[model samples]
Target chain A: MPAPLSRRHLLARGTTAGFFIVAGQWLWLTPREAEARVFDPQVLSPEQCKALSILGDALVPGAADAGIAAYIDLQLQAGDESLLIGKYLGVDTPAQTEFYRAAADNVISLAGDKNSMQTFATNMASDSLSGWAGPPASYVLFVLRADALDVTYGTPEGFERLGIPYMAQIKPDKPW
Target chain B: MVSKNCDVIIVGAGAAGLTLAARLAEGGKSVSILEAGPERKLGDLVSSQIWARKLKWSEPAVSESGNHKIGHAFNAGTGTGGSALHHYGVWLRMHEGDFSLSSDHGVGLDWPLNYEELAPYYDQVQAEIGLSGDSVKERWRPQGAPYPMPPLPLFAQSRVLAKGFAKTGRHTSPLPLAINSEPYQGRPACHYDGWCDSGCSIGALGNPLAVWLPRALAAGALLEHNARVSRVIRDANNTQRVESVEYLQDGERKTMQADRIIVAAFAVQSVRILLSSATEQHSAPGNHSDKLGRYLMTHPAGTIFGLFDEETYPHQGVTAGQLLSHDDYDEKDAAGGFGSSQWMIGHAIKPHDLLGYGTNRPDIFGAELEPWLKRASRHLGNMTVVCEDIPLPENRITLSDRLDRDGIAHAHAHHDLEPSAAARCTQRMSEGADILRAAGASEVWAGPRIGQHHMGGAVMGSNPEESVTDAFGRVHDTDNLYVAGPALFPSSGAVNPTFTITALASRQADHILSIN
Candidate 1:
């Protein structure tokens, strides 16, 4: 038998690796690694993932690199067990998948020739995008921005980046 | 269907239910608690805000409507400890004037009992589960015994925020909390890591998992997790008594018989269970007067954020804040608004999550976001304004047409803040911003108003025609049915409701024991 994993070792591993399906097998990998490895998303389509990555990165720099799309995709597939902040914003888990899908579709529909992504984000924040459809653009922006922050600055590593102490009494086994 | 019998049956394993279970079981009555959520242990409470979402209400979604909706998904909780597990331990007592809202001010419903009647229970609960605070500093506090432990030391953030109160000529006190300041009753002292919102893993915080669950188990009270109660079944022969409770567990429908029943499932779910108990021969146990789910209330609350010049280290204390200002608490009919209000200052906060600085400002993003977040982490100071919610008949919990997979109807909450209450909240938030500016904040902003603590769905009152339950939380028109927790509160005071919820359950336990 392999050596038993100590509590410290398990915590260390947990902080970095989240459960993800890679190549028809369940494996522990960071969201960034999962994104780099092109893990199949169970809920969001490839096009939807691309849109989410672009919009999320525009909302918070480094969000795409932090794997915001993979993170949100995993949460959406979790159904009632989803840890997405949208749950607290009155969007139940059953509705979250559709909310994100529609929001991403609207983002995709925004003609690139009409405005830059940053300009689109600015309009989205103000609810001023002329042809924007689906759930209120400002509300979607808020939720997506919150999601980006969660993926980027919501963990111990993220705390270190911001110069704040994690100070966890019981560290999370899964970052999300 | 499997069936079990107990002397007393409680519908929830929250603060109120566990308190009753511990007390009643210790009094030699066989007790069984049915919790709708899964079991939770101390080790299960992780420190990440994202992970903490597991502790919140998840399934059988409670639909909400109207302006200023109750925010049920955010406010309510699931699992063993219920909402109390993730609560920020801001234990506060309702003022004497709060009990007499209708009698004194000709507005809202009045409590069946007054402050003096509930004072001893508050004192008892404080002693049982050690509270830390300087009562002498809380001059607005109603008559009660002093806190058991000295107040937790204030950090730099509170020191800076207290200066703002001083400059504004408002008195501030150590916020009374149910967290241990030092080693108390075998629990260690709080590490002041500011993860209270994520559920405290240590025994320092007086969550049900830390305080009442052990006592209840030791006293022979059996707890059933994932037992979603459908309704209370009235006896076929004796219509006035609730003989058995029907529930779903592990994909099986089951029933449990008990001599007495108490619905302690927080505010909304408790009322939902009772509302589901309606029969063709009789109205719901407390709905004879069409008042079972009426008078729903939630504190109209908002937070004011400021960017300070000094190194505040905003994440150095508890999430509930370090200092409190009740300077404007007593005068309900004050110039601007109708009800009482208080300020919880210097909250230990994070850069992410719902209430975090990063999420609060959706305007700044891309290259600008990270730099701002880093700065706010060090300099942000925030305080929440909690204002009393005027209980209205229209603000209620009703059965929604939507059904879950189990065929049980979902609960729907509709709440619109009264104009006067909204006005009061607006007035206080403006004042809070001014106070922050007075305290030398370089910049100040306020978050949107949201509902905080919930109360008053199955309210307790002197008249059965006017209320759902009597003073002892006994459901009117029923011999052995009761409602506990914030559901028994007739008015939503500005104060946090957990302390009062525990005290009311303590009183109900004593009353039930005496009758037995």
Candidate 2:
């Protein structure tokens, strides 16, 4: 829960890699960028998209690279709220859609509107979110937490691609 | 009426049935096994780490209703080799103490056969099917022939967890799996790809397709799939002797007569068949003991899932599990809060392994599902705690009043953990998680209550007053009618049930031969 760097420090240390978009498809490197820069949305306002991207970037080293932003946006637009997000966070409360909705609103409040999205995220990290409680934390923390989960868990990037080998613990040898 | 007869009418071709059929055919007995499942090819049995979701009991299918469903949606095996075609083949011998746990230590009821008494039979089955394992390192493994082949290699998860056990001053070793580590009895060595739940297509996994069934077929055994046995028919005047077996074949009612019969159709359904048959025939003769559908046991599993800073291919090599701690398998210890325990099996999880996801609460479905899946691929390390489920009358299998197409009521299997059983599983599992954490995993968490191995309903014992079948698995009231499979387990040990099922089957085969 105690993150090492404060918001200003994080921004100072954070490095942004420019989108090397190829053709019209808008090739994405991080899930965070996929939300910030691209994602088809008929439901989410542009401000909502901006807030989701800002929140994702602070969760992992390169969530934007993973296209997570585009993923969540698509889910919201499609009205598929049974994301099991509540289940994963250990919350038994139903209507996770409501929870996400409240959290997103709170995140935007802390983040601010449209053009001020980046400043708002920087502000929440340093000020308003310092001792943030309940639903908003659940939302911001959960989204980043899951993105961190994805980058680490079942993907090749998490296991095989990470260059970790399954150590041969048992001595598979001739039976005596 | 003209008699419909066959050389030998065997009931249920799951593990015991298939093994006996193969042996009988080799012995020159004309045999036909009646199984109620579609014909499954090796291709059909292939599946994900969680194999049950893919396999279904085709014959006498069960319809469950209760707070705790047996989740048998695909629990029972159908097709030629029966469950063996899809079994993980985790061959383990019951300890000498396992035989008389109740009488010896004042805990659960004792099995009629002792470890020494069952030893030869376990040995026979192992040799017949070529077991691959290392009982010596197990420290607590019972006296027996050494495995024909070496133990399978433990993946990084098992290896790391073994280190944790060492650190915690507990013991962990390479699990004595039935899977082949090297070629034994003409079967090829395992590829270490960790695909045991889906039936092993390569024959390296020691499933029936790779072992006994093939030999049984070579010995001239005939397997009739889609033949759901509904009733064990006996002449009303001579109820002790079975006259024929009634079942559904090709959507038509049919019966096959034989000199003797063996019912090995798994635990729950087997009991349903007996009770359903008695609805018209004999007032449920075994019901005299009032234990027909009692003492149901499943290795109700509790699991611990953890994340590691290190990379462990939590998915590679015989995923059902590969490290074991059987020191606590003794009955007295189990009756105590210590609980019965085994180490060799933990859930083998892919990044998206369903069980693993339950451990760490995070988004599963909806938007975040994909990211969690990718993260699970690398940082996951997990283990499970397996314990014996105490039999309660409530946790039983009974024929549903509503009949199926064959006129046999669907068997309703109702199972739930007694408080003691649930607690027992929880305590042992927490101990396991502590061990994994010590192994240097970055994060550690626990999964939900799971039903993996199964048991009970038609338990065997010496007294007709207390149990349904006699020591040799013969129904106390009906001499010629027999039953096998986990259905006869008085109490499921922390150990896996397949080995005991096969050993008991061999014991019954010998008894049948003698009586005939």
Candidate 3:
């Protein structure tokens, strides 16, 4: 649930040092690294990306490792071709970037180092986050969780991890 | 301009458009279809849930509002096959009482045609599409030809949930589905993989890709992909007849002329197309009565989920669910509510996505997430309750003031659930939770009441003053323009609308053919 290995450092260093530290494991080249090795975010800021990764990981443990933030950033850059679950939830494509930013900003203001990540997540679920702005905290939590689930267990590999059959009539050549 | 003439020009390549196109083309008529989205084939339906997001409505977003919002993006789809490509294939007929809503309950508008008039077409469509179910087991089912295929095998979740219906003195029947149980009509049978929402790539489910698209293509129907229809064009000399259509294709505005035109772009989009057809000489076709976008309706529905001690294997069957109970479907005057409702029991569920087990429970996460998901993956029991939405003229679709980048006005859908229908949905959801508890569930919970299907707007009626179209789906104001989808429905029946949409299209095709 901790923040990603600062994008500032990834830029300061070269592509060789661009490694994601997930679940105490040092992966040489994760999917996130492979997809966006030199990350230049279009819609999301570094702080917003960090906040989304933390929030998503808190909701779904392996989501950070699943590159939820990268997946989201990629979709945001996709514009009308966004594959985000929020697209299906009635958040218009043009407004999706603002929606995610505002929600992430709300999370940042609420979780001012005083509360644990678990406490923040629980407050989010209960809609008890004081002075919360933007969309309802519960709704934001739902969207983030859904996004996390998308990356964590929405793929054939993820289904196999849970012992469910990955029966495919036409299998996806690549995970989004 | 890529100008061409055809016998018929159908707007939108969704279920209704494809069905009508296939039928008319089979009768030796040259058919042309304009689809707002990309071309989709059965081979494009990948099995991964993440990749499945591409199958949903990816066109310009439809603005929605009101207490129970019509879930346009979730319910509607884009591309060649349209929404039917990603549908779960739950095909149920509207009950006889569903035809006359105002006459029976004094609530919504009554359909121009009764179930008996539509029943023969429904039978013909069902037989053609190959529905699988046991008619005798469906005690409350209306009279029709028995399903062409035996019912799909029920999984453990359905078996467990059936006990709840039995314990509550209710009868359970195998869910009628458009999915093939065995290899039929050269299409492969379902593998019970539970990916219906992701689009059935194997041609097992009777999606447009497997059913109508091939027929339409084989019968020489020309489908124009990525061609977003702007408006229907009326002839200058004869204002009463629609002569052509204006549309955008490959970044160029083009016009296509035809002897006949049918707008089958689903409910909201269909209404948008008609409303955008407004000209100075005449208002939008079907707007003479000021009832073009009136009487919008969407079913108020929810799901009930539970954790059972026994191994349920919830993901072993179809996504449309495995069983149905219409024992109380026809009861409109129940104490708690005033609309018909039905229960689709035991869906083959996943751990993610909107209706999946994981997303439903945002409370269980962090360190305690994987175990819960794993357990639910193996032992979850779930069923959905679909309550009828009574049509209200105030709940309508209108052209939004804001326009898309392409200068086409976006469609705004406003729908407020009727108090009676809301009450009925709440009651059914509560009963569903109780049923889960009675079915030996260790824990049970109810999901939020969300909009299920979109229907009505540009409704059909006997009186031209009250409705946009006549019984034949032809607009009263225009001779050549017709609507052939759920948008033509006068009443929002509790059952799924795909079967009825196809049946209505069949009827419309017959009418068109008989005209000349």
Give me the TM-scores of chain B across the candidates: 0.99, 0.92, 0.99
Stretches off by above 4 angstroms in model 3 are: A1-31, A34-38, A112-115, B1-4
Error of model 1, residue B381, in angstroms: 0.7
lDDT of 1 by residue, B291-369 (tens): 9889999999999999999989998999999999999899999999889999999999999999999999888998888
Question: In terms of DockQ, which candidate is stronger, 2 or 3?
Answer: 3
The order by descending TM-score is 1, 3, 2
User: Please, what are the lDDT tens digits per residue for candidate 2 over residues A74-164?
Assistant: 4444332222232323332234445555555677665544455444444444445654444656445544445444433333344444443
Error of 3 at A3 (Å): 21
Q: What is each predicted model's overall lDDT from 0 to 1?
A: 0.91, 0.64, 0.88
lDDT-based ranking, best first? 1, 3, 2
What residue pairs are clashing in model 1?
A: none
Model 2 docking category: incorrect
Angstrom error of the Cα, residue B479, model 1: value is 0.4
Higher-ranked by DockQ: 1 or 2: 1
For A52-155, candidate 1 gives per-residue lDDT tens digits of: 98889888888888899999998887889899999998898889999999988988898363237888888887888888778999999999999999988998
Kindly report which residue stretches of model 2 are placed more than 4 angstroms away from their true locations once superposed: A1-176, B1-4, B47-52, B58-69, B105-107, B279-281, B334-338, B345-347, B356-372
| CAPRI-style docking class of model 3 based on DockQ | medium
